[model samples]
Target chain A: MAEYKGVMTYCEIAEGSLPSISREVAGFGRKLADDLGEELCAVLVGSDVGNLAQDAIGLGADTVYVVDDPLLKEYQTDAYLSVMEKVVRKMMPRILILGQTSVGRDLAPMLAFRLDTTATLDCVGLAIDPGTKLLLQTKPVFGGNAQATFTSDFCPQIVTVRDKLMPPPEPDASKQGEVITLDAGLDPAAIRASLLKRVTENEGGVRLEDASIIVSGGRGIGSAEGFDQLQELAALLKGAVGASRPACDNRWLAPNRQVGITGKIVNPDLYIAIALSGSIQHLSGCAQSKSIIAINKDPEAPIFNYADFGVVGDWKKVLPAFRDKLKELLPG
Target chain B: MRIIVCIKQVPDPQASSSGTKVDPEAMRVIVPQGTPPVMSPYDENALEAAIRIKDAHGARVTVISAGRNLAKPVLRKSLASGADELVLLEDAAFEKLDSYATAHLLVAAIREIGEYDLILCGRQAADTDAGQVGSGIAEILKIPCITAASKVELSDGKVLVERVVSDGFEVIEAPMPALVTASSEIGDLRYPKLKDLQAAQKMPITVRGAQALGIDAAGLKRVNLVRLAEPPRRKTECRIIGGETPEEAGANLALKVKEAKLL
Candidate 1:
């Protein structure tokens, strides 16, 4: 029997340096490695991503494995999965951590299937059981209406975590680790799907993920035109404009601005929810906001339960007055 | 072209925040009786995407659902929405299946169907939200799978899929006999006409079990669901800013927000 040992995090990179998700998962993996009293290993894959090995060490990885190859440049299902399989097979880490982003979501499960182990997706909470040393994976289910904890008696327990749930570890340049470069023996014939073109919808404004404050509207905002008012309010506060799923589905806002379980998870300092009844799925996205303010006519709207301050009224009458009051309160 | 769309019947995901209850003892959600189950939202998009392809290229779209006891009224909607056939893979073991097991069953069923050009599934079920089965099936069958597809077109012996990514979308092309997972952005399931609705209800549904599908239910490893519970509630003492009129209330709310110094 191959005795799986230590924690391994699959590091993701965009442009050149590691993305925040890579750091976040590394931080999370660091905690697990500590609990298990084992080495934390990070795998850096992609074209010329070897420079990030020390960075991963600073994020708490004791050993960083670099598989820098041109064939592994962009995330193709087969290329990345094949790379991950070789890494997992070679190292045989007891635990594997991945971000619930585009690449991880696609790769983790397939890798799990190939390895004959189970992979838990979108896990918001994870812990190592002190008694038997099993990974307890906690994740939301039933449209975020409820959460479930799961465990499997399998080696290399795999998990993909939702974003923004954990902060990245503080970087310490003093930290050092061993970097092992592996040959990515990938075959071009193994690449099944090909990326033709990429289209980026650049909504020129503060990205919801990086925003300190978010002014979000919902179905009650009515139409596409109503978002302009939300945008104005967001601009006044130097924040970003976000929307509930309904608003996005109605084409009133782009899907990227959606804050919910299936959408982007945000942790803005202040979340202003307008004309939106808070659903569990939506709250799963923005509940980490430092403070929430809700405005809706229905006093019983669930948003109030999570709001620090709330106003009961029609947004049509209130928004204009809000603009006026804020305009008077602050300077451009 | 033959298309297979996988759908799951779940407790209404569109239900209000308070519509669900978790039975921790059973580690399952207790769906209230009399509240009919609806097709998971993304599966509807998957069906709609298939129908769009069917309308354009004249392909046969078959809807396959694997569950314990599915609602026919709900399953019929796929047909009413334009699926040409309905196949249900049902067994007691079908309930609360882990992604791997579900994928195992689906791959078996798809094999039984024999020939297929494309396999379409919802990005993830509105229930588990695991989003793994599609990728698993593709892997087990060794086929290319594109997930979170917003737009799919069959063009010149290839499947062109506009997949939803974090920053934007990516146009991916794969050869025939591929799989694609539809995201909600593809568009909601279309409402069927009265004639189509009637025809769908009368449509014959093929039902099979684990034994029939050649799946040894007792042999698979099931991920133990330890417990089900409500997320820890954030108890916020809400201060309702009030005034005589809506405008006055808005002004008061603005002042209160500043006082809070949230940003």
Candidate 2:
């Protein structure tokens, strides 16, 4: 039998707490580590974040690396990557995993370049091959038309798993693990870029990627003015508004509201695609939605194949009726 | 100043899957025959940025491409668009090169071309969407790289770039002879003019082999194929239940909203 090294999961911080994606990665990482007969280690870098370190251990990490630094309070790619590079060089783990969030997307490629390694981003699945001990990374490819599995015969195989790929870890507080503290070694001069200001979207609801219910519009929504109806419908459902590439391309909505390969990947519990013809790029983003509702006048629209239910009619006429029915079924 | 723009040709985004599996033996992806190819969207941005820089800084732009012989047409397209010269890095050796190896080959080729004030590439190739090529090139060349750049300006022998960051943006200034990956907003792409298109038809294209780049063709190996599976199917469950009239439907929708626990 071949011996296996441990797995290092980058426990991401969000909303001043451990993001749900971190627990999901930890749960999956724990299973992989257990199968390999190795421990799961979690790494956390933040300012005075020792208290949050235990949650990672309770989730699944057998050991937690805590780098408490005042400079690490906010996410600065250069600073974080610098510390991560130092930590990775010291630990030399077999596999390194992170959540495929915006931060992860920004850091993974840079880190890979720094480490002189290759990383597969937005991975949906991961495992270890028993014979070669290679970490098998699977991710959507070619604008979600296919899934590609990749492996590197190199050390510290890295991947970033998308959110909701795995169930959140069930906490086991009784299972205690060791927590080691380290200084992140962050120097102000090391920071090359300075944050000017953060401009968040003012009308906030659930983020499309993380939302359970999503209502989307497409070119068939007709005009930018038509989006208000979709917004009204989305508000009625307490769901978020998403747009097909055409809608975004037409500037009917913000780029962040676009759902497709170039936009945001969403897997909502219920996805309502309005007046969408279902272009592959648009479908790629919402294909993972638990249940898809496509409302279009064209019955032959490509989106029908991917949708769970279809309503062939004018969206301007159909959406309000559908919204009312949904409201009828689940009244506030 | 000399600027090098790395360009790649990809299938139209609207086209069906032409991606094959990792296992060459069991490859099942049907490469669509007679599919129209386009300059990768990101590469278009790269080309536009290169043209803009050339117009402002009086630099000569060289278009570089790596692919099979079939990529000649794609290379010519770049030349027609405004590039001063074209170099095609073609060989069986580059057939299976991944991002890392591809970057190495490109760096070697660039080194052979001698000094350059700047290198420009798309933030990512549309087909693979790996987004590692530019960064990998920067690493190999040991130059500062700015990725996801929405805006770029040259002043005082330095490149000032606005890199897209989460929440907002950040400005980074690097010295000349830097590599910058361009984002879509860099500039609007221009179509090839009649005169340029006519000239492009007569333009001489230079082709280089992998051996010339110091990479052993046999060393380019694909380790594993992640499976190529169809996208998950989505089922639309849309049903219409309200609206005696359009106005009635809106009122009913309001009532339904209250009933649905969503209001």
Identify the candidate with maximal TM-score.
1
Error of 2 at A206 (Å): 3.5
Q: What is candidate 2's lDDT per residue for B1-263, written digit by digit as tens?
A: 89899887777655654332233346444446666677787888888888888889888998888876545666687888888988888887676567777787788789888888889998777777777778778767767677777677787888788765433356677776888888765655678888888889789988888777777644644345645665454454444434466545544544543454333
- Model 2 over residues A1-332: C-alpha lDDT tens digits? 13326899998887678978888999889988987888899999888789988899999899999998998887766688889988887787788898876677767777776887677888878888888778888877666666778998766777888776667978988989999997787888776544434445425766776678888999898788899988887887778898986676566776567777656777787788889888766777777777776777787788777775566668787777666666666636
Estimate, for each residue in B153-182, the C-alpha lDDT of model 1 and write its tens digit.
988999999988777789999997999999
Point out where model 1 deviates above 4 Å. none
- Proportion of the native interface contacts kept in model 2: 0.34
The best candidate by DockQ is 1
Candidate 2 lDDT for residue A127: 85
Q: What is the TM-score of chain A in candidate 2?
A: 0.92
Candidate 2's C-alpha runs over 4 A off are A1-4, A187-190, A193-197, A320-332, B17-25, B56-58, B153-177, B185-188, B217-223, B231-263
- TM for candidate 1 is 0.97
Q: Please compute the TM-score of chain B alone for each predicted structure, in the order given.
A: 0.95, 0.86
Residue pairs clashing, model 1:
none
